[model samples]
Target: MSDSPRTILVVEDDNIVRMLIVDVLEELEYTVLEAADAAEALAVLNNADQTIDLMMTDLGLPDMNGKDLANRAREIRPDIPVLFASGYADSVDVPEGMHNIGKPFSIDQLRDKVKGILGN
Candidate 1:
């Protein structure tokens, strides 16, 4: 990975899951931005000056669904890559070229997917 810190937006409703992802990304030396729902995610994206390198979002949310959030984020930041994490593997239809990490994923799996998306 490059020495420069990459910014990652994590939109997850589950507090534990969100924190786990934040911790992992932090350990990998990436700057992490967190959102509990789509609204917060959009707010963060709207206020961000630089491009967000990656986004890891849960498929289900209290507000808008993660897939919709990802779509909206893509509209504003087309270059940013998205990774959807969900237990409902068969339910959500992820965007083309986007990535998905099943709910019970291992740390290695998460790391590999993020690395692959960032082209590390």
Candidate 2:
């Protein structure tokens, strides 16, 4: 394994969900960074030196939606992958070719999706 940790930026407004995703990522041996909304996520993306291996964000945020956040994040880092985690999976207009994890997901599902995205 590399000395530098793989970073994942998780953007979710709910505290419990945020912590759960963080825990899962940490357990999988990736470094996890968090943001409560798109603005905060942008700040982290702007400041972090390590490449964000992937981003998992909720579609419903207090400010902008996750798709918009993903677009902005891509503008800053075009190659980074994004995953949408939302209860509104059937409703939200996600960007084409982006990945997603629906709400109320199990740990196994989350792990599988993360691994699939990271190609681990």
- Lowest summed lDDT over 10 consecutive residues: which window, candidate 1? 88-97
Clashing pairs in 2: none
Candidate 1 lDDT at 120 equals: 68
What value does the lDDT take at residue 3 in candidate 2? 69
lDDT of 1 by residue, 1-120 (tens): 557888899999899989999999899888899999999999988875755888888989899988888889888888778999999766667778688989888888989999999886
Looking at model 1, residue 87 earns an lDDT score of 90
Deviating ranges (above 4 Å) for candidate 2? 1-3, 91-93
Candidate 1: Cα lDDT at 101:
87
Error of 1 at 36 (Å): 0.6
Regions of model 1 farther than 4 Å from truth: none
Best by TM-score: 1
Q: What lDDT would each prediction earn against the true structure?
A: 0.87, 0.88
